[model samples]
Target chain A: MLEIKNLHVKLEDEDKVILRGVNLSIGPGEVHAIMGPNGSGKSTLSYVLAGRDGYAVTEGSATLEGEELLEMEPEARAAAGLFLAFQYPVEIPGVGNMTFLRTAVNAQKKSRGEPELSAAEFLKLVREKAKTLKIDADMLKRPVNVGFSGGEKKRNEILQMAMLEPRMCILDETDSGLDVDAMKLVADGVNALRDAGRSFLVITHYQRLLDHIKPDVVHIMAAGQIIRTGGPELALEVEANGYADILAEVN
Target chain B: MALAKLKDDALAARLAGLPASAASGWLAAAQTEARARLAAMGLPLRRDEYWRYTDPATLNAPEVPSAARFEAGDEAPAFDGIDRLKIVFVDGVFDPAASDDLALAGVEIERLALAGQADIHWAQGTYGVLEARGQTPVARPFAALGSALATEGVLIRVTGQATRPIALNYHHVSDTSDAILHHCVKLEAGANLTLLESGPGAARLTKVLEVDVGEGASFHHIRVQGRDHERRAATHVFAQVQAGARFKSFTLTANGRLTRNEAVIDLVGPNASAHLAGAAVGDGDFHHDDTVFVTHAAPECESRQVFKKVLMNGATGVFQGKILVKPGAQKTDGYQISQSLLLDEDSQFLAKPELEIYADDVKCSHGSTSGAIDETALFYLQSRGVPRAAAQGLLVLAFLAETIQEIADEAIAEDIRSRLEGWLQRHAAKGAT
Candidate 1:
């Protein structure tokens, strides 16, 4: 369950406004895809919800499970079950991928007052999850995202999402640099995690990814606001004819 | 010149307080030569090009500034887990009761005080030879001072592969002790040895370690400068590596008021390899400097210089490194990189990297960079549920990992890593976030 109402945001260092009073809500187990043209504030919405820096939420609120997400620190938001799959995953030269994942998992567990996983337990679980994403031992041993290809990076993000098991997941342009096969693999991983207690906000530019993991609903956004809301067919319409027809009609 | 007169006055004042040594025969001759050299060069001054980034006032002062001994608090001393021939020193004086027997299988070891009294010995040829050679391009008056005035040290001669490392453990007790020590190590042809040194010997310390790696021999040196925050030290490592020989040296420095570690390595034979690396973590009131010069004189030699520093809360770090490839030294591969991770705007890092190649076929590359923590990487880690401080600590360790990998021994590397982790945890509690 995720909710965003009248979400207005502006760059912290500049006066330029990005998201302007956008409203969206997703219920439990539901998958929603947001399609928008360039600079329409689709990615900004995800960043604002995930509590990223460089953005000032001028007005409105975004909540996860009735908890104010914007007011919490990024780590607290994560502990409270918010996950953001970045378009370009950061490449950390020194921190190994396995170490990063383990630290994150244990940190969340400790913050939640749950027992931390032993090294053996963690290794087993991560290996199982990685198997589905086709991430080998070497990938897990290497530094996070350092020298990783586009497809590998996206898949690594998916693996992290699976490991963290956040209640609400936001994928910001996860399909941008991935090939069709990689997209399908990532979609399968995401589909396996879909259940009654989990929700997804898939922000994409095309309908090709939606084809792999069918969405329950689709929203067409323009100029910082959601101009239209429909079913999966809305994504098909956008693919058939670009956003030009829809933007002109909405104006 | 006014600069020369100032240096002369400073050197004279500092030399007036030296503790007298009863030198004789060959040792007396060496000490006399070293004293002449010091008198000619004088102590370093702030205006000198060599001491540009770091001030030499405190190191040049006559009176030793008192340093409070650090209570490591339940942390095991460095290299305690390794099997080594322990030679202990307290306040720069050899502690025979605390040291092991002066005997090892493949090496001949003797104290400098005992060996200097002998009329003739193998160490007489190397006592200050490397130190004098290292003073040519740069005037290291502190090293000359140590060689001329030191009353205690160790002399080691290796003729075969050493079964275990030789550990020089320094324990600081007297707050006002001014310690000077000189050590010489000669590795015979085809021999191998590893030397380990640790601790803050005294309030104001000057140390010189000269090593000669003979043809086809190998020498490995690892040092962990003590954690006394108010201590000031000037340490020098002068090494000459022969043909087909190997030389590797690494140092880890934590908190100290002032620390200058200078390493001068000369590769004189073909196919010889040398590596010099250092990792330092400094907090407020800390100043750490690593000055290294490596020379390649023979064809097909390789040398690498890697140094990294982590500074926060107004701490300062300096690096001056140079690599020279002489004429006819074709196929020389030299690499140098110095980097700093400044945790805040108040901290500063200064670096100067130089490469001189007379042979056009040589490949020498050098890089120097100072940067803040990668914000994107930090945010990514935080997004995964790691707290801000823990994430930063991880990144800092990662930054130092490249330099730590230069160590040939895995156990020693692991020990160093744990020590760094302990340092990070202690500082993190002081609001590193």
Candidate 2:
């Protein structure tokens, strides 16, 4: 389970507050949807939770399984079962995706005091995962995100999330650049990895992705705070009427 | 005091009478020039600007006399799997018994001393001079010394229209207790050849190679400097490229106590091209320096120089690269990048990339970066279950893969990579325990 309590964060350089007293909690076997328009601090919440540098946490605490997540390093947080599906994946030249993924997975395992996987075993597992995700094996062999199409990059990210098998994953705009078909495939991949003891926080600008994953709770974020919280029908209301009516009521 | 002075005087006299050679007219002249230069400049002291990073005093000792001949022992060492034409040099002397008469259809491989005077004259006329105008001050001592004592080397002539890649392997093994001066190699026009030079077991060996590529010719030169630990070696390669010719040089300096691989490439003709790439791994108390000088003399020419150095423990590494675009050389594309990674705090690197362009139309840039390994990447790998050493090794390999991947020969590149990985593993194990 992950918990964010009245989190207020600001940029380190300019002291401009981005996330203002936003509170959220998600337990295992639950999916939370945070829908917001541009400049709504949705991505900021993801970065703050993932322990990215340059974000100053002013007066809030983020805990994963009762462990202090905000104080941990980004990679340490990742090893601690926290995953962020980046809105735009980084392009690392001269590093193969398979090599990077293997390193990441093995690093997490080592941190957990687990036995490492051999090259053969890792290859077999990754190839099987690739087939289920509709990802070409050759794409995994190429440099990470280099020369890949936008959709392929997004798919590769999901494939990484699946490979890491984090306990709590924050999907930040995983459905933004994907086409209708790619969106369905990526949603299906995420759903396949879903289980009772795992949770997901799907952040999106559209309600289309939610139609597939079907979140248990829907929250509308405005300016720098979450203004409204409702069940799944809230997504339908926002989709049909838009956030303008909600923004008016919240302001 | 007088008795002690007498002993010192006797030692100096013995050193002076040490049977040094003045053979080969050009070599004699070069030695004379070097002695004069040494008298004026003296042995580069710590105060010299060019030698500031690497002190020559630590390596300087009374010069030993060059050996006259390499004595042949029982059987030569076996190099069974390597298919190239093996040219063996024992104690700095060329061995015909070990060398196959490379009677390829269009290529010519011969000892430089045995080559006809006309051919030697042609080579000297083509590539002998160092184009002294822009030569570095640090090179003065070595150039003078090499020019003075280099008597024999290899001359490889690939005739125009030849296709087979000529492999020239220089195997140096010391038989007697003497220092060796082996100067070898010359490539001719339109001839495409791949030259692999290695110093297997050399003790105090110095080999100088002078290469000349004719118009429209191509040369692939790979130098593997893996001498014995006690050996103090230096290999200098001077290449002169003509119009429409191409020259690519790759150097791997993995093992040596004190090794310096210096290359001077001159783009003499219009539209000529040259690629100089090298990777050096120095651990222990070893010291390695890779210095390159690429000159653009003609218009519309291209030259690229990439050098990578990895050092551990108290080992030291140096990469000094210079790109010079002359006044009339317009539209020249010259790029130089030198990077170094120090694995320990005591390890040191001095990488300086200099660019001097006199032509406004030229695009010349040089960058030098030196840093420790990326800790974030290290932690990233470590958190993924890779042990600390394995993670560091993988990161170092990824860092060096940029340079190694540029090698055109798959086998050679893989060989170099495996050797580097092995070295890293050994160093990591040492650190672990």
Candidate 3:
């Protein structure tokens, strides 16, 4: 469902490269977890696929469902069913969370030549989805991410992913600031959305989150590229003995 | 010396043939007195200290270019369906034929024209009294000019709580009309009133509003400068807040070639409070300025000034606000904030914020900022599938939301908000192309 070959990316404002010659592939219905230490180009790979600016794909090709992802704008990418649950969800002061989600849902639908959900219809759908994630209706009424606790923000991100129902989803460090309870809740939300047609690329620094939402495959990333790829046992190995042995083996 | 010479030259070229006649009585004498002061002080020049940022040439012309009369679309006019006393003015002349009678509960209202040609009345003293009082620290030549030539207005006196708001609705009919309007409001102790003003009065409009708020009185003013894209107007409000009085005013301006709104407020009694706020949206060739001066003369007074402007595509905005606390006015609270959202690289904002304090134990703060939209916020919205221009429009409305909240009346606030939203929607469409 997703493919990247020889992807090399450098900061647009600087010459230093962040992602160099990374190759990855995920099939439909597969949950792939990318475990890496800090600054290991795991998040960079996700950002490059989601079409964020400030990075130049110097040499690489990325496609999703046979459509090139490198040439689309961020919104177009989202409309093309690409979702990125940011590590630090932005706090937009003036826009209410409900308004933001509704606009986003309608926009994606319109881009895909579908009818928009009426206000009443949208409200009902959001309430049902929010109940599962344990998000109070009050959170949706307030401005987007403003004054929300870390757990609430993560839960909100999961709610957005469920509502968008993207074909390919990337969760960038969704477990960084979450407690164990919050992690389990987030994992449950993600597990419920998993299907034969939807795939997820979860990026994390530890295997704590993988316990709840088991991954089909695990990749250990060091420096700028994926150095090793194996079955779910790879995550357990990385968790048991940090990334040192893997780095030595790759070198 | 240079200012004097420049002022003199500007006066000759700008005020050569404007009518300054009034009824033959003390009112006329007051007009003559103000006219004499205007001649001496002259008009402000681009080189003047206060006029440094905004050029006065367009407003100082002998003849103001006529703006195409605005025809409001199917949208219900502002304050529609609200209980109000509608007072109409066409081309700066009172149109009683289309106005409600001056009958209202707890209030006495009279047209300035009724104090006919040969009599001295109560309005004679208040005609230019406050305008002259404000000339002490700053020379507001335009305000003095408004007092000198103004002939079309009303005098309203509130002795108790007014049941309905008074609406001053101006309608423009003449293309080259030059209008000067002066309104005087006196509220007795413990009285309450709300004033609503809207519409494009003329091609070139100058207005002065003087309010005498007695002890424990409450007054509110909300005005929407009409959508005449080529209109040139300068309006001034002079207010005196007595002990424990409350005065709050908010203005929402959508479009105009040039508009200057000046307000001078004096907190004369202990515990008095005053808030002055405005929100303006301007497109290409638009220029809007708000100059406010507030004084704390008695102990424990509080004052706030909040001004926000959104300019796009070569539009310009200017703000010059000052807060002064007198000696022995301890425990005074003064706050001032002026901000501008420049949608593009070419738009501009100029601000001068000042605080002059003589009291040692007072809290005063002021800040000004001019910037483009928050790029991160814009991206966050756009990344959610909202179009780029729509995202920009949302940010602009959010930027102005703070000022809109200053309105004390919820219904009026909602009306102003929708008006701004409508403006943003239309402008966003224009920008998209």
CA deviation > 4 Å runs, candidate 3: B71-75, B116-120
lDDT tens digits, residue span B1-433, model 1: 8888898999999989886667876777889889999989988998888899999999999999999999999999999999999999998999999999989998999998888887888877788899999998889999999999998999999999999999999889999889999999999999999999999999889999999999999999999999999999999999999999999999999999999999999999999999999999999999999999999999999999999999999999999999988999999999999999999999999999988889999889999999999888999999989988899999999999989999999999999999999999999999876
Q: How is the predicted docking of candidate 1 categorized under the CAPRI scheme? A: high
Residue-level lDDT tens digits of model 2 in B90-138: 6566677877665666766656555523423444543335523224534
How do these models rank on lDDT, best leading? 1, 3, 2
Best by lDDT: 1
Instruction: Give per-residue lDDT, candidate 2, residue B117.
Output: 35
Rank the candidate models, highest TM-score first. 1, 3, 2
User: How much is A223 displaced in model 1, in angstroms?
Assistant: 1.8
Each candidate: what lDDT?
A: 0.94, 0.72, 0.89
The deviation in Å at residue A33 for candidate 1 is 0.9
Per-residue lDDT for B1-433 in model 3, tens only?
Answer: 8878888887887777676475566667878888898998998988777788777787777887878888778977888867899999997999999899998899999887665254767666577888899987898988888888778899998999999999999888888888889889999999999999998789888899999999999999999998889888889999999999999999998898889999999999999999999999999989999999999999999999999999988999999999999999999999999999998888999999999999999999999999888877777776667777777777787788788888978888888988888888898888531
The DockQ leader among the candidates is 1
lDDT (C-alpha) at residue B251 in model 1 = 96
Which 10-residue window of candidate 3 chain B scores lowest in summed lDDT? B114-123
* Chain A TM-score for each of the predictions: 0.99, 0.98, 0.99
